[model samples]
Target: MQECLGFYAWQGNWERLFGASFPQTTDQAGVAPLLSRVPVVWFSFDEAGNMTTQNAYANRPKGWEKMVDACRGRGIAVDMTVAYLDGPKLEKILADDSITDRIIAGIEREVALFDGVNIDLEGLGSKSVHQADSRTLVRYNFNRFLNKLRDRLQRLNKRLYVCVHPLNGWFLGYDYREIARLSDGLVVMAYHYGPTPEPYEPVEQSVTLALASGVPQEKLILGILTLKPYEIPETLAEKVGIAQKHRIGGIALWKISFLNEDFQAVLRRLLQIK
Candidate 1:
């Protein structure tokens, strides 16, 4: 069966069937259906990869364990997602081995409360690392970084996954082949074309390109943004069809905090289709 993942964001106050919440509830009776459909919940810790000096234990949001238990109670695997979008800063961290070592150490510490860690370090591959050139070196070093981080997480028996930009997109820092080999899976963020009613061809092309780059379909997870204004059930199902057509490993919703009845309805039907 293809996996279905829902990203549980920490930034939003969600309105649920029980009521709106500041500390959103995932284990509620109303949310059980959505949580049950999702095999995994990617907890957005709002942490960074470039920040090497961090205390993961002390940094958790209040009542983090209970929140995690809520999802785990439903038999869902909860993984932590660490993100860094600053291009220059990420490039610098990738260029220097010492910097990456610290970053990896910091990430390893953060995963103790998680089943796995998904690194979302953006702004590389197509961009320069130390200078205005050398995109190849950026990919080389990133591959090395993933290799090291994967080893560290493996020692802890925690899975390693990378949230990557689409291969057809502008950013080229991710070496899909090497990353596929290093990480357990690749969550391809395949949305954001321009306006509402985004094109699905790009999503299809991204999956195709990833496969062409030698990434196995089983290791690919198509990441779709469910918060878009035009993302109705019809549009959402089209994206799911792309993943189904390609036989990818699974699909990841950008977040579950914004999940309304409409989005949940689409997922219920779409996920069952596969």
Candidate 2:
């Protein structure tokens, strides 16, 4: 299968990006200059309230239709992200069936705007303390929500995708087995490993977990981060290359803003050498 590339960006920056193809407002355009060329784009937005103080793409941006149209002209696919974490509001919403319906309905409406939906439910409730006991509950409820969401998307002939972070205390509540079974494919956010107490290849961790979860290798999409503060030290970089040799599936970068020349070049070399 041909591997895929995806770029994450706020919806508002669409115009500035079009500048790379400046002076040409046509359907085919822009600075798609980067390693592992992205053919799909993922956009995250806050719903119902301002979840993040940082401004996100306004629910929908003007001219996105034209922009997506332009991308589709180049054979690119566009997808949207929906995040639901455990919190007081989530607790209240899940406790009340009617409330959950209303909230999910709203999410479905937002999801309908794109070709598919990517669910990012990391950092929900406390995971460290109840990782073992809460794992099944979290997975069960998550799957329930997806089943409902899937029904809604099916009516619109839309696809569903899931974004999973690498093993982190925050996501200990997640049951990878059930999640992989429910999701169409997994977008493993595998780049945070190298930024911790001891740096390591995030993709390598993802590969191990993905295989352990019994998630089909073809259904796994290795995720990379354009962000920095990373120290590869020659040895680990070579190990990373060996990990990528497995060719599990596609690859996607976290955000476009985090990418720099040096980072991009390293990724290019990895992909080329792989």
Which candidate number maximizes lDDT?
1
**lDDT for each residue of candidate 1 in 1-274, tens digit (9 for 90 to 100):** 2567776554341343223464555334334444422322332222243442123311235555665676666676777776667666677777787777877877776678778877777778653333335777878888988899899998999887788888777787778999999988888988787577768788889989999999988989988888767466788889888889989988877776666777777776776521
TM-scores of the candidates are: 0.84, 0.73
Model 2: lDDT of residue 132? 62
> Can you write out model 2's per-residue Cα lDDT over 105-211, one digit (the tens) per residue?
66565655566766666654455545565655655665676677777878888766777766642455455666677666677766555443224545576677777
For model 1, the run of ten residues with the poorest summed lDDT: 37-46
Model 1 lDDT on a 0 to 1 scale:
0.70
Q: Candidate 2: what lDDT?
A: 0.54
Clashing pairs in 1: 124-173, 125-172, 125-173
lDDT of 1 at 47: 29
Model 2 bad stretches (over 4 Å): 11-60, 84-96, 194-198, 201-203, 231-243, 267-274
Each model's C-alpha lDDT? 0.70, 0.54
Q: How well does candidate 1 match the true structure in TM-score terms?
A: 0.84
